[model samples]
Target: MPRIHFIAIGGNVMHQLAITLARKGYQITGSDDEIFEPALSNLQSAGLLPKELGWYPLKITSNLDAVVVGMHAREDNPELVQAKTLNIPIYSFPEFIFNESRNKLRVVIGGSHGKTTTTAMVMHVLQQQSFQFDYLVGAQLNGFEHSVQLTDVPVIVCEGDEYPASALDKRPKFHFLFPNIAVITGIAWDHINVFPTFEIYKAQFEIFISKIEPKGTLIYNAADDVLKALVKKQPRNDIQYIPYALPQHDVKEGITFITIERITVPLKIFGNHNLYNLHAAYWVCKTLGIDARSFLTNIQSFTGASKRLEVLLQTNDVTVFRDFAHAPSKVKATIEAVKQQYPLRHLTAVFELHTYSSLSTTFFKEYKGVFNMADSCAVFYAEHALAIKKMPPINEVLLKQCIAQPGLSVFHTKADLQNWILQQPKEYTNILLMSSGNFDGLDINELKNNFIHL
Candidate 1:
């Protein structure tokens, strides 16, 4: 069995990969400065957790087959430096994933938002069809055993992230995958700490398109004007390009159904954005030879990926959903989904400004008109987050003014946010909690229980 050591294993995907390899009978060892719950507990459960935290260069030996590098590790990370000194092979997470699935058909989903949902949808349909395939998805799904899987399967579906691969490799993660089949959900400027400009951010997608294998297929979202223009500008004669838009659908009361010809398919997921994701997934599956009838039939059971508009609690008159929507475009799409799903209900959208991009004052203008659908809107940002990111203190008044939501409420404390939520009227209401952070360790289940019972 191959022995692998991870430089920074506490990352969500890194830990999962370690556990997966351990389960596959590989010898796995890892180190990290700090290990958080879920990742810590999961690694411990797998018997792959390191005995201590912090880097130990002594663990890097010539006997190790390879070192898997996590993006969280710095260029000068002691173990990483040691591994290089020892002449052991080093692979970024994406690099290793591509290495493992080099012989398989790679379907890489890329975009700023909705890629996870789209990837999950594709995985769901393929699993339901009982097709043997490997996958690496961003979030935990209903039937998946782990986030990363490696087998002798002939096909692999990956949620192609555009973030930097690792500290040593500054290229975008998806660039290394070199997908045979590529899907771009949409492009919105993100990761400002790295790209720093909208043009640079968009250029990454162009590079990704150029990286597609010769004569391979490119599937994209046609409804995204920016993405559409980009695709049109680059005419790839060797590649087959396919664009998908939201399929014709209906929302009756609270359920969403898409009708095609004489067959009407009911979906467990709601929202126009989700509909668009589903359309993209359908095209991907179709390209892989799954018939349109079987694709729609199998997709009916896909609720959603975890934390992507996941409905946590529901009552006869009230429903509460939690989503990972820290970006501006995602925030707007998520709120619109709930509003469009329950058109009669009062939608209360609460967003946590948690990510580096969202917390920075420079990117606040992108969110100006994203909250018009909410009957009531609240924005929360932990004060300590600013200190952690080394950003200047945010003025709540200015933030509210910049968001341009006249009656928006802004809070810097978790307690204040909790109180506001508990005090909300419960009749005919839909509550959406959107964030990439935990809202300063807010227990979502407990909050949902309290709200639903009240």
Candidate 2:
């Protein structure tokens, strides 16, 4: 059995990867500076958790087979330094995934917004068809308990993130995968802390496209102008390019109907972005030799990936949804999708400024005009976020001005924001809470249980 040590194994993806590897009969041992619940509990259940909480250099032995580094670990991590001193091979999470699945047919889904949904769709279809495959998705699906699964299966579906692989690896995570079947949903500027500029952010996708295996296929979203441009610029003649767009769909009584050639299927998930995601998944399934009809049949039941506009509470008069939308394009797309799905309802969109980019004063202007679709908007920023990012205090006045909505409100305190939410009229109002963080550990479930009941 290969002995693997995971640095910062307490992270969401890292824990899942460690658990998956452990289940495969690999001897997994891991350490983190601090381990949080769910991850800690999950790792403990798998018998892979470190005996203690803190990292120790003595834990790294020369006999260890390999070390997997997570993004949560810093450059100067003690365990990481010790592993380097012992000349142990260190692999970024993505790099290790590539190494593990090199013999399998790799399907990498890359994009800023819809990669999770697209990956989930492909996995759901394959699962429904009883086709065995390994996968690494960002969000937990309804049927799947874990996000990362590695098996002796012939195919592996991976959600390709454009973020840096690790502190030591400057390459984007997707760059290491070298996919056999690649899909780019769309290109949108994100992770400003790493990419810094839109041009630099878009170039990552270009690089990802270039890394496709010879004679492999490139499935792309034709509706996105950026993706279209990138696809056009591809110099590889051996790569097969398949472009997708939104399928013909109509909204009736707050539900979306997707028409696939002769078959019209009513879907539980609605929105243009989701429709685009479905199309991207359809092309990938087709390339995998799955019939379009069978793929569509399976997709009708996919509610969505967790936290991608997940409905937290719904009553006769009000509905509340929580979404992992932090980027400007994602913020705009999510709000528009919600409004378009329920045209008659009033939207009270609450957004948390949590990401390093969103908190940075330099990148704040990119969010301008994103919240104009909402009937009312609230922007919340935690003071500690500024301190953590080492950024100057975000000017709430400037944020409000940038959002440009007449009734825009900004809050620096969670108490004030919670009280404001509680005070709002509970009828015909759809609350969309958007963030990548937990709003500084706000109890959203408690809010839903208490306020919705009242």
Candidate 3:
């Protein structure tokens, strides 16, 4: 059996990868300063959880075949330093995944948004048809036991993130995949801390396009003006371009039904963005030889990737949804979707400025009219987040003014935000809690229960 140790194994993908390798007969050991739920519980259940917290350089021995370094691990990490001294090979998560799937056909989905949902959609269709393929989706799907899987399958589908591979490797994670079939769902300005400027952020996708293998296929969204401009600006001769737009669909009493070949297919998912995602997924599956009718039949059951418009509670009068939407484009789309789905209901949208981009004053300017559809809009940010990100302290008064929405409320604490939500009249309304973080550790279930019991 191969021996591999993880420097930081408690991440969403990291934990799943650890368990994957363990199931593959590798001796997996890992350490982290702190491991939170889902990851903690998952690692514990897999019997791969570290007995002790914090780094232990002694764990990095010459006997280990490799050290898998996560983004959470710094260059100064003792285990990493010791591994270097021991001449043990170090592999970032993407690097390791690439090595594992080197012989397989890699279908990588890359974009600023919609990658996870699109990837999940493709996975759902493939699984429904019983197509045996390996995958590394960002979220947990209904039937999948793990988020990452390594098998002898000929194809590997991955939700390619644009974030840096690791501290040691500053290259974007998607850059390492060198995909055979690549999909760019739509590029929006994001990861300000990593890419800094919009031009620089957009350039990464261009590089990603260039990195696709010769004779590879590129499926992209033509609806995005920015992405379309980029694709046209940087023409690729070596690869094929296949563009997709939102499919023809109709909404009847809150259900979105797709029209294909004069047959109507009602979807569990709604919204223009999701419709775009469905189109992208359809193209990818079509490339893999799955017919249109089969794709439509299988996709109806895919509720969505976890946290992408996940409904925690739904009644005829009230519905509560949570989404991992911190970026301005995602926030705007999600709000519009809920309002469109439930047009008559009053929509209350609460968002968290959690990511570095969302917190930066320069980037936050793009969010000006994102919440216009919501009847009530509230923004919340943890004060300590500014210090942690080494950003200049924000002026709430100035920030509120920057938002420029009438009757907009800003929250500095979780308790105050909770109280505000509880105070709202809970009749004939839709509540959307949007954040990449936990809204400063606010218990959403408790909030949902309160609304239900009231």
Backbone clashes, each candidate:
0, 0, 0
Alpha-carbon lDDT, every model: 0.91, 0.90, 0.92
Alpha-carbon RMSD, each predicted model: 1.6, 1.6, 1.7
Measured by lDDT, the strongest candidate is 3
Tell me the spans in candidate 1 whose CA falls farther than 4 Å from its real position. 443-446
After aligning candidate 3 to the native by TM-score, how far in Å is the CA of 115 from where it should be? 0.7
List ranges where model 2 is wrong by over 4 Å.
449-454
Local accuracy of candidate 1 as per-residue lDDT tens digits, 325-438: 989999999999999888889998999999898888888888999999999989999989889999999877778778999789998888889888887778889999999988
lDDT of 3 by residue, 62-85 (tens): 899999999899989999999999
Give me the runs in candidate 3 sitting further than 4 Å from their true place.
Answer: none
Model 2 pairs in collision: none
Q: Which ten residues in a row have the lowest lDDT in candidate 1?
A: 253-262
Residue 175 of model 1 has an lDDT of 98
Please estimate how well model 3 matches the true structure, expressed as its whole-model Cα lDDT: 0.92
Better of 1 and 2 by lDDT: 1
Cα lDDT, model 3, residue 274:
96
Native-to-model Cα distance after best TM-score fit, residue 19 in candidate 1, in Å: 2.5
